[model samples]
Target: MTTAKDLLIIAIEVDPSGPVGQGDLSLALAGAELIDLLGTRAVTLTGDRVLPAGDAVPEDRLLAEAVASLDREAPYETVDDWLWRRGRDLFAAYTAVLEEDGQLTRERRRRMSFAAPRTTVAESAARRRALHRWAADEPVILALAAAVGIESEQTEEEAVVTNDAVTTVLAAVHDAVMELEAVRRRRSFENAAFANVWRGA
Candidate 1:
């Protein structure tokens, strides 16, 4: 199954300069993995946490490793931490797979280097078409939006086209995060207000 991770590989392949910069690529790629896992019903969210829905281990290397990693710290973990940790490793693995699958052409010397190599997409029209379709995918759009912090009401509202359950789960989580953020903002305002009042006194 071509996942969000695969689509991200395509996005980077087509544009070596991606939507997000090098420093944020890991987080975006990791979020792509979560999007894949969530969409496939391989995992489910529980109050902003993620847990495997079933015992079936995946055959895909990335999926297998992700499920396995959850085991080491079972009883589930925060989606934030899990995605952050997984993003770093998945970026490397997916990049290698893209080169192996002929989707990306990389300089041999660059492969041996510690940093990511300069790479380009394959010259296949069919592969490009598939990627174009995936890029338009609602989940992919959501993941990309998330990666760059591009807030869009249209994207969230459009998420129903993918999976209503996933959209609902994400919305619930979003509400919680926003609420906490609002509280923090309010507290900061109050703190500043009191400080000004004390200075005036």
Candidate 2:
């Protein structure tokens, strides 16, 4: 029986050239949103629509709550171990669904390839690139929900809620990217200033 414990959470984010302090937090929030969306979709699709509507919270807050809820409900030996395992599973499921639905292309597939028995290094590089692009695109929320088995909906309410959730999450991602860019620029300016002031004799 696949319980909530079997489900995994993985945060996705836009990559900053240099690390930003908030990058991890943003990604963690994104992952939580994906988990929440997926959990909701899973229950609904399974005819077990008991989970609460996630319409009230902003995307980041929703994600935070989801993570907290998962922590309270799931038993794991260590937090890091739990996160790593969950990330791997979610990534695999997300990639597979994208491929099946034609949302993932051959070029993207090449970019997101990995070193498996039949794949070359070039393929692995391509796979990595594809995954990076997808991460940058910020489709993890919808993709993860689809992976857990959400299909085309007939109800206006479901459609509206899902669309709103996706939009909210994407907006949060854009803000995170901009924030990261600002941090990178600040670091660059400071580095240049320090270098210019210290002339080695």
Best by TM-score, which number? 1
lDDT string, candidate 2, 82-102, tens digits: 233334434344434444544
Candidate 1: lDDT of 131?
A: 64
Residue 99 CA displacement from its true place in model 1, Å: 1.3
Which residue pairs show backbone clashes in model 1? none
Best-performing candidate as measured by lDDT: 1
All candidates' TM-scores?
0.62, 0.33
lDDT of 1 by residue, 13-116 (tens): 54556454443555555555666678678888776677778677777777777777773346667766664567555556776776686776865544456865
Candidate 2 residues lying further than 4 Å off, grouped into runs, are 1-66, 69-162
Candidate lDDT scores, in order, read 0.60, 0.37
Lowest lDDT block of 10, candidate 2:
1-10
Candidate 1 overall lDDT versus native: 0.60
